[model samples]
Target: MHELSIVMSIIDIAETHARNASSSAIEEVELDIGELSGVEMASFDFAWQQATKQTLLEGARRQVNRIPGKAVCLDCSASFPIRQLYDPCPVCGNHLLDIVSGKELRVRSLIVV
Candidate 1:
């Protein structure tokens, strides 16, 4: 699945950074996954385990920090949390909310030793 490729990419990036620091091995890979990022957390975790099976990150732990989706209303300047992509602003009840957060999937940090 696509998660395999995504996990593979993550491993590659982490490996590069870990090597740069001269770390013996990567202990953990931390990720910030926004709620609206369209990534299934459990699937990603499973894919990560499968993808890193023979790589340097084989036993590396993955820590996911889930970020809630948020939006700012352009009409009322109100901010609200969104559960889905098409969710309207809770305060203004408007669809003109500008997305301020979420829709992101990236590595935030790592622990190496």
Candidate 2:
């Protein structure tokens, strides 16, 4: 699955940073996953476990912070929460909206020791 590749990439990044920082090990990896990031959390977690099976991050914890979907209505100039990408604005019921969040998947922090 793609989550395996994603987890491998995360491990690579964490390893690089840990080595650069002269840390003995990685304690945790923090990720910001938006609602519309198209990633499966369970699959990601499983992939992470498999990816770090024999690495220094074998015991490292992954802390995922979920970011909610948000849309800014272009018609009403109002912002509201959305559960889907195509969801209309709650305030104005407008389909003309610019998505402001919930489409990102990024590493926010790394805890090494």
What is the per-residue lDDT of model 1 for residues 1-113, given as tens digits with 9 covering 90 to 100?
A: 67777888898899899989999788888898888888887888789768898776889887888889899888899988888878877776888878888988898898999
Please report how far candidate 1 places residue 98 from its true position, in Å: 1.3
Write down the TM-score of every candidate: 0.90, 0.89
Residues 2-43 of candidate 2 have per-residue lDDT tens digits of: 888887877788888889999988888898889888888899
Stretches of model 1 off by over 4 angstroms after superposition: none
Q: Which stretch of 10 consecutive residues in model 1 shows the poorest summed lDDT?
A: 84-93
Report the CA-based lDDT of candidate 2 relative to the real structure.
0.85
Candidate 2: C-alpha RMSD to true structure equals: 1.4
**Consecutive 10-residue window with the lowest summed lDDT within model 2:** 5-14
Error of 1 at 62 (Å): 1.5
Q: Model 1, residue 46: what's the lDDT?
A: 87
